[model samples]
Target: MFDYSKLITGDMPGDKIQIGDSHIKRSDTVFPILLKKVKASGKTKIVISVYGGSGVGKSEIGSLLATRFRSNGYGAYVLSGDNYPYRIPAENDRERENRFRYGGLSAIAESDGFCSDWMDIVHDAWLSGADADPELAEKYEFMRDYQEAGKTALSAFLCTPEEIDFGLVNRIIKKFKHGEKQISLKRMGRAPEELYFESVDFSSTKILIIEWTHGNNSALEGVDFPVFLYSTPEQTLEHRISRARDKGVDSPFTSIVLEIEQQKLNEQAQTASITIGKDGELIV
Candidate 1:
């Protein structure tokens, strides 16, 4: 009923992935439509982005689509937007934490609700990485102010030029579309020394699949078809917990990040050429 005859997974280094029945079904929903568009466009090079909320299976579904495309006699590659972040995971985590704390405290200090006692409490909450916990906010009213302000600041920081190297990604897309045979693609790791690039053959590639959380991001140009795999934060949480994607994936602070990401994805999903719901049903 499907093809896994070739590699459709993203090129990110050191990734352990699992694709499920739902992902396959969703990919099947969109692949034929995408193929039709690719055929009609008559463009030698086409870029498709598979993006969605955290743990929504962008990487998994993108790979499946790519594999089907290749097995049907078209060349394709899945590029990871994760590798384009300005900082490594460890460094970026620290920066995001700093932003949340700073942004939250700054707002609280400026508001009439500024109380040294509450400020200290909020400070401690952030240190424990529970500032964004809904239960904590409900238990302690002061946390609500910090959580709101922190998420606002995160909206300004996440997936923007400050965090993601959109320019570099755009340039790579340009080269691919302009007939570059082999291109140097970036590879990033959790450490400083892990930043590097590898020359990859794009000579036979006709369709380029960028599977990432930020694939639908505004700064990422040149995507002829944008696909959004929609999943609510709660849904994503369950999946991430099962996958053991990373440390703190189930943490409240991480949940705050996922909330912010979902907000952005919802806004971006409007423009997606294809959108799949959590139930593996096509929404758009």
Candidate 2:
């Protein structure tokens, strides 16, 4: 068991982040696997990624694992994937909104037969913040296509190179694997001006672990161990609500985003080195 009182969490986790009993159990389950993987690597410095749903305890478990590594006489450090996005959280969120809204309207605009009256109704729906409601599609059949198109566009943008700076994170991994003692990591916050490079001294960091939603993304490289935390979108949303990491998490748009992200995660699960279920059990 880990000392839950003294864990070093990810760099940019939510201020309201909580470490529950389940987190401790998952870390206990994952620590030995990670240690074996690191030892088998037989390399001077190795990179690992703890990936999963947005609020599936990646930060808490990741920190606990790092603490375990240190207690076992190995050096460890945790890097956050949140800081690798191209834009700060707020700006990136607005961009996601823009992409979604554009996709919905463009689907109708590019149709062979555009309906001005239908567009008028959609305009009204947008004004009332009901454009994304499924019930709206019941009244207007065309809204179903519009909503699906919007969600598809959002899916394309989420976690892709268009949004995340996979190249930058890759370079950092390269440097770490090459035994660089000092590295400059990106730190992105919610506000526009909170972007900066943080110089981290890695002289004693033998195992560099990254805890992130897209940690197993194909775009990212040099991950010796990819540990995935599996959870349904509904479970993830419940966790997000409790964390209150950001506002508007309970919105329909946000729910759709989580669903898309979860779908992608499931698609990527086959390549994961380790998988932890929602109930803190290993998924073979």
Candidate 3:
């Protein structure tokens, strides 16, 4: 049997691991051997993405993998995709309504229908080039050096209790889309854009990882290589309740978790029916 713990902890050969009908493999064979070759050749940096659901330990595995790559003396840069930006729950009705109105509009901007509008900003920044932002460019260089050493850069946009405020998400989305002004975070100074540009420069080999929670799996629509952590909905509820207990949060949320788990199981069964017959496999 495949070890779920090993997969979560990311313990396996660089080649691949097979479990049931699913297989987990490295992004590419070149990934494992790139350190010596890239250092000797002095080539441009490479970028990779590691994506998975939350509680499945995406971030933890990403860190360990990045560390291993660095230990091989290869320039490895690991940046978590969670650092982008998002909104938090509103406290009151007024705050919640304001967020809903603004959030609806922002969500439109983030949609595929508004790709041109968003891409315009990207193009303008690219045309203006690095000279327009020498400071950012230099910061990138610093990041490249650190990344070349195999350091994992941890960042996230998930709403934690402390950071939960709809206003913050609006600001982040606005700054991200319009580029009108820069915003700073508590621990990390400067806006996310500034930090992102800086990190890119220091990394010759980049691995981007994201662990998603608090939303639907469809949230990762455009991701290249996506991985889903599969388990029964019963197991999911058990996991959530166990986690909540571990955190000292004794709430009525267990019932809510149970409800969600039931709904998820129904949906999963429906999907399975569509993909495979009662006996499994598709009809010829």
Q: Give the TM-score ranking, best first.
A: 2, 1, 3
Candidate 1 at residue 154, lDDT? 83
**Model 1 stretches astray by more than 4 angstroms:** none
lDDT score, candidate 3, position 102: 38
Q: Over the stretch 1-284, how does candidate 3's per-residue lDDT look in tens digits?
A: 22334332222112122232212222222234434443554433323234322233334434444555555554444434334333211222124223322333344354454544544543453354321233432554432232222111101112222223334333432333333233342112123333322312332333222333321232332222232333444454454454442331222222323334334434433222112121222322
Instruction: RMSD for all candidates, in order, please.
Output: 1.6, 1.5, 20.9
TM-score attained by model 1? 0.94
User: What does candidate 1's lDDT look like per residue over 1-284, in tens digits?
Assistant: 66465556788888766878888889888989999999999899999999988778888888999999988899989998889998988889889988988888888788886688886777677677777788877886667777888888887998799999999999999999999998999998777898999999999999999988999898989999999998899998998898885788888888888888888889998899999887779895
Per-model TM against the reference: 0.94, 0.95, 0.33
Tens digits of per-residue lDDT, candidate 2, 1-284, equal 34567666677734344778898889888888888888887898888899999989888888888888888887889999999888888889889988988899999887777788888888898787777788887887788888999999999999999999999999999999898999999877787677788888999989888999999999999998899999999999999998887888888778888989999999999999999997778896
lDDT, each prediction = 0.87, 0.87, 0.32
Model 3, which residues run further than 4 Å from truth? 1-53, 72-74, 81-85, 88-201, 214-222, 234-284
The candidate with the higher lDDT, 1 or 3, is 1
Worst 10 residues of 1 by lDDT: 1-10
